[model samples]
Target chain A: MQVAKTVKDINNWVRHTKESGRSIGLVPTMGFLHEGHLSLVEAAKAENDLVVMSIFVNPAQFGPNEDFERYPRDFERDSQLAEKAGVDMIFAPSAEEMYPRESPITMGAGTLANVLCGKSRPGHFDGVLKVVTKLFHLVQPDSAYFGQKDAQQLAIVESLVQDFNFPLRICRVDTVREQDGLAKSSRNVYLSETERAEAPKLYQALQQGAAAAREGKDPVPEMARLIQSETSGTIDYIELLSYPDLNEAPDGQAILALAVQFQKARLIDNIIFTLKEN
Target chain B: MQVAKTVKDINNWVRHTKESGRSIGLVPTMGFLHEGHLSLVEAAKAENDLVVMSIFVNPAQFGPNEDFERYPRDFERDSQLAEKAGVDMIFAPSAEEMYPRESPITMGAGTLANVLCGKSRPGHFDGVLKVVTKLFHLVQPDSAYFGQKDAQQLAIVESLVQDFNFPLRICRVDTVREQDGLAKSSRNVYLSETERAEAPKLYQALQQGAAAAREGKDPVPEMARLIQSETSGTIDYIELLSYPDLNEAPDGQAILALAVQFQKARLIDNIIFTLKEN
Candidate 1:
């Protein structure tokens, strides 16, 4: 597989692919790949003639106090996995290469970006949308793959694509998970041995919430209590809201999400379940 | 030439052209086409296999107090002008069609958008960049055209293209002017008989500034004074700054820009020139 480390290289490679009449697909990711990212790559490979996986650990998406500096990255390991997953090209740009100058223009994701994770980490999704938009422009892909693990991120990206009229389809892959039910995340590596043991409780609580909502019971309170009782971690938030919109989840299929801090790691997980129609 | 009033029609048309191995160029304008807008279409025709002209008088770019409602638009005239200038397609989406939902995401142009005309018309460049970015995405042109008459606007769009890594070229056509030197603008129709006669002085003052700068003299003060002395209109501003950046122009080259108010019409003009290296 070809590896591109600069904007010019990727643009040339993608353009050449277009000129040759092959459909291009992009799976944008930060490195330290796991099954979740690999799942996106798999989906991309399934649909397109060529798949380009971007492995840039974007610092713009991380806030000043967030773990931007400590974000894990292993290029050698990621390259091997991408090749194994049938990626045609791996575009791994350095921070300096991705952002040559201080960005003079930025996207402000309005109302949708102001809820859930956005409340805790302000400007995070805006940063994500900006980089995603840049990658979309550079790749000019026929389709782009994103993981449903980062559901809010995926939804915001879909909004950006639709609102801006980007000529591409967003294919969402289901969240990849550990056998015990912990959603696979790069930050999962940061969990202490004890924290790792407790991580599955986050997703378990989400399933419980979904089950409760399906059974005609209010899920927010029970879900919040379940996380507090089952895990030794500190609860950040346990929200039951409409999928994608994150508004109050009315009487229908909605998302129940939670973020919990376990020592050095913050783990997030969610589940979607339906209630009787209103 | 085909005229499309919906997004789907234009996207399908552009996609067909791409599939047939032809390059598409875009000339985005706010209708009421003149020689200036036609020059952009002419430039687009010169470089690409097909040219798509977008006639959207974007309300997002106008302030509540601005002339958005009164902005002159004549589709019959514009269609004839575009066809005569060799445009292949005209995408004229209505405001409702263009903005199906109030935009959830918008571009904030940061420092570059808050100066010069941006200062007087807050959120103006933001609206322009948003719509321009949308057109760029929908049209998916190989190249896009803009007139140097709106120099600041041109620079901002170029910045958007580069910063976002858009897969297209920005072809900046030189400002088209009348014999007496008034830059061609659709807003020219707003001028009264006397205002129309006096408008050329705006360009004259810019030339005077360029000449003085070339002769090793400070141009801002004299340029401001010249506009006041030569025109009966009120001088809103007469400043000299660096091209594209709009920062303080050094000894090598600079842009002289101005805004003048004549009864109902507000006219703006600028000239770019170089001096001996400092």
Candidate 2:
């Protein structure tokens, strides 16, 4: 498998692939390979002639006080796992290489960013959009793969592609999960034994919320109540809003999402479903 | 030459061209076919296998009080002129087609946009960046052409491409001028008989400023005084700043730019040059 550590290297690979009439699928990620990231790569490989997985822990996407300093990175492990997962190439650029200078063009996430994760972490989606814009230009992939685990990010990215008319497709892969129903996440490592035990209940609460919504009932309060009773972690938020758009409409496709803040980690989970007709 | 009035049509042409391993050069313009725009077309034709010209009077780029409603457009004339100029295709979509819904992503021009024309016209560069982003995505050209006549816009665009690492080159085309040295612009039609005669002085003042800067002398005041003494139009602004970055530096390459608001039209002009070593 090819490993590209600079923009020029990745672009060279992209150009050669395009010249040979091969379609590329990009799976953009921060390093520390896990089941969730591997799932995206698997999805990308199935749909494209070449699968490129970008493994940069983007500094732009983290808040000043956020976990940017401690964000896990294991390049050797990641490369081995990516190669094993059938990734054709890995783009792992350094922070200096990725951001040579401050960008004069800044992208705003608009109203879609003012809720949920956006409310707690301002400028987070903007940073995500910025990096994604650069990656899209650098890779010029035929299609980009995004996991449903970061549903808000996926929605915002989809909006960017639609609004800007980027010449690519967005493929949404389902979230990888543990057998006990906890959403698979790199942050799952930060959970204590007690916190880990309680984490599964977060997803369980979301499942209960989904069932309630399926039965034509409002699910936010019920979901919150379940988490409050079961988990030791503090509830960050629990919301049931229109899927993708994230607006206050529950009749159509909706997402029942919640975030729980533990001693060392903040974990989030959601279930997207179409509400049954009343 | 093919004339595409829809995004899908343009994408089809782009995809077909890419499949055949042909490079595309884009010359984005707001129609009324002036000599300046034709010059960009000439530049694009010389560099790429296919030249795609986009004639879009982008509403996003215009202020509410600006000349959006009255922006000059002659599609029949433009199509004929473009065909004559050897344009391979023209992508001219309607405003509704370009902006189907309010975009959830907004682009900001950053510090580069807070001076010169940006000061007088807020959000103008933001709008330019927005439309340009969409165009760049739609065309996906190998190189995009821009006239140095809109020096600020060119600088901002160059910054965008550099900072974002867009996989394209920006070919700078020299400004097309009248026999009397006035910059050729579609807005030239709005000038009255006497104002038309006085217009060439704008370029003359810029030439004087360039000459002064070449001699290591301050040029802004001198350039402003020359315009004030010579032209009947109101002096909007006259300044000398670093080329491209548009910051207050005069040592390296610099630009002496000015704007004059005539009775019915606002005309702008500039000259870019490298300062001689002291």
Candidate 3:
């Protein structure tokens, strides 16, 4: 696979690829590729003529006290994993290259972002939208792959594409999880031995919450109590909201999402499913 | 020329145009075609294989008390003029069609929007950015044309393209003016006969202000005085700032801009020129 480190280089590849009448698929990520990221690549590769994986630990998406400086990054290993996963190109741009100056245009995630992960980590999704905007412009992908693990992010991005009418399709890949039901994340490395054992409970809680919602019961309090009683981690939030829209009423589809703060890592998990009408 | 009233129609045209390997140029306008808009079309035609003119009044850009309801539109006339001006297609979508639902994503025009027009009309440039984002995605033009008559808009747009790395060029078209130096504007129709006669003084004041700046003199007070003495209209604002950035103290290029409120219309004009070092 070809590895490009600069915007000019990737743009050149994109132009050449487009001139050849090949469709491109983008899988945007923050390096230290795990099974989850590779799964997105696999999905992208299946449907597209070319698959481009952007591995940039975007500083814009990180808050001041957030783990931006310590974000896991291993380009050599990432490149190897990307190549093995059948990616056509790997775009690894420096922070300086991606953000040359303060952007005059800022994106705001409206009500959809005022809940769930967006509540505790304010302005985080706004930064995601900004960087994603930059990536979309840079890659000009025919389709982009996103995991359902970041369910809220997927929803916001879907809204962005729908509202702005971006000329691309968003492919929703199923969340890649470990045999123990723990969602695969690069931050999983930060979890202690006991915390690692506790991480799987986060997903289990989401599944139980989804089950509760399926049975026509409010899931937030039960889910919160389960996690509080079972894990050492602090509950950041536990929400059951309308899918994609994140509104209170779950009309057709809904998401049961939660965040738990361990000693070092903040683990997030969610289950998105259709709701049955009573 | 083909006239598209829906997003799907325009997208189909865009897809076909792209398949033929031809470059598209977009000239976004609020209809009521004049020589100024036609000038933008001419510029687009010279540089691109196909020119798509979007005649959207963009309700998003107008404040509640502003002239949105009274914003003049004549699509039949506009299409005819656009055809004569060598436009390939006209994408004229309705407000409802363009905005089917409230957008979850919002754009903020940073410091660049806070000074002149943005000062009086809150959230104006943000709205402009939103619609322009939609148009840019819809048309996917190789180069988009903007008249420098709306200098602040042009600057903010340029910043948008640069900051977001949009895969297009922004062609700056010189402001088209009448023989008497009045900038051609659709709003010019709102001016009373006496106000129409006095409108050219706005451009005159900008020219005088630019001349003062060229000679290293502060130009706002002098230009304000000149317009006050010569015109019966009230001066809304008169200021000189660095071009495009709109920051205080011009280093290389500067803009002397002003807005005049007439009996019914608010007229604006500016002169953007390179500043000679003192």
> Interface RMSD of candidate 1?
0.9
Interface RMSD of each: 0.9, 0.9, 0.8
Give the Å shift of residue A277 in candidate 2. 3.5
A215: Cα error in model 3, Å: 1.2
Report the C-alpha lDDT of model 1 over A230-259, residue by residue, as the tens digit.
778888887777776667756565877778
lDDT of 1 by residue, B111-203 (tens): 886666877888999999899999999999999999988888988998888888999999889999999999998888888887788788788
* Stretches of model 1 off by over 4 angstroms after superposition: A249-251, B249-251
lDDT of 3 at B141: 99
Clash pairs (backbone) in predicted model 3: none
Reference-based lDDT, residue B254, model 3 = 86
Model 2 lDDT at residue B12: 92
DockQ of each: 0.84, 0.88, 0.88
**Weakest ten-residue segment in model 1 chain A by summed lDDT:** A244-253
lDDT at B51 for candidate 3?
95
**How close to the true structure is residue A181 of candidate 3, measured as C-alpha lDDT?**
98
| TM-score for all models, in order of appearance | 0.97, 0.98, 0.99
Candidate 3 at B7: error in angstroms? Answer: 0.8
Q: Candidate 1, what DockQ?
A: 0.84
Q: For residues A1-278, could you state the per-residue lDDT of candidate 2 as single tens digits?
A: 99999988988888999999999999999989899999999889988999999998999999999999998878999999999999999999999999998877799999989878989999999999999999999899999999898999999999999999999999899999999999999888999998898899988888888998888788778778877888888988888888888998667788888888998899988898899867
> Candidate 3 overall Cα lDDT vs. reference?
0.91
lDDT of 3 by residue, B1-278 (tens): 89999999999999889888999999999999999999999999999999999999999999999999989988788888999999999999999989999987899998988887889889999999999999999999999999999999999999999999999999999999999999999999998888888889888888877888888888888888878898888888887889889998787888888888988899988989988898
